[model samples]
Target: MSLSGKLETDVELKASAQQFHEVLCSRPHHISNVSPSKIQGVQLHQGEWGKEGSVIICNYIHDGKAKVSKEQVEKIDPVNNSVTYKVIEGDLLNEYKSFKITVQVTPKGTGSVSHWTYEYEKLHPGISHPETLLQFAAELSKEIDSHLTSAK
Candidate 1:
């Protein structure tokens, strides 16, 4: 089997596409305020928030376990409402040689749709696809959507 793979999922959100994209690119730290149970905190380590090449460490919970990831902002496309992050260090690197995550939000009527993509190369074929991680992302998106919708 190939050691590299990609997985993607789309989540429907009640918040506008601009709002969703802005939250991720401009103020990702607010995610903890929206979903404290899923995302413990997002701390900027280098550069600045929303800027390319910046680094942030995210503390989160997955599968009932707390985990951390240090990621660099690879790209931020305001026109496309997309943001890409490359994992530089984290628990996920234990099984995968490299991991990249991209999120894009698109307008849909008065609401929006958030697309999450995960690309990774495994260290060995023994590792399974990160389906659980995608599920975690989907749930987290829903939580953030709920908070955004309620706050408005």
Candidate 2:
């Protein structure tokens, strides 16, 4: 397998795409209240919210264990309904030299579909691939979608 690669998946969701984008880009901290079991908290570590270069620290439960990710907003495209985060610190760095995740949501008739992409460079050949993490992302998307639906 290549040391550096990208993983992409598109999942259809019942939630509005624009609402999902807002939750990710602007009101991420609110996610904890929406899904307390999956997401613990999202705190801005530096810069300002909803802007490129802003760093956010995310705390969540994955694989039944707590994890943390500190990432910087590399880009935010409202027109495309996409947000890109480049992980700079936390548990993920233990296995990857660099990691980036891009999430894009687009309208799909009455609902929406979320596209998740993971780009990473492995720290060593022994390191496993990130299929589980991608699945985790997909599951998180579902949780968010459910939260949005129930908030109505």
- Winning model by TM-score: 1
Q: Which lDDT tens digits does candidate 1 get at residues 8-93?
A: 99999999998999999989999999898889999999999999999999999988999999999999999989999999999999
Give model 1's TM-score versus the native structure. Answer: 0.98
Residue 36 Cα positional deviation in candidate 1, in Å, after optimal superposition: 1.2
TM-score of 2: 0.96
Worst window of 10 by summed lDDT in candidate 2: 30-39
Residue 34 of model 1, lDDT score: 88
Local lDDT at 149 for model 2: 88
Task: State TM-scores per candidate.
Answer: 0.98, 0.96
| lDDT tens digits, residue span 56-147, model 2 | 99998988899999999999999989999999999999999999999999999989999999999999889988998899888888988998
State how far residue 138 of model 1 sits from its true place (Å). Answer: 0.7
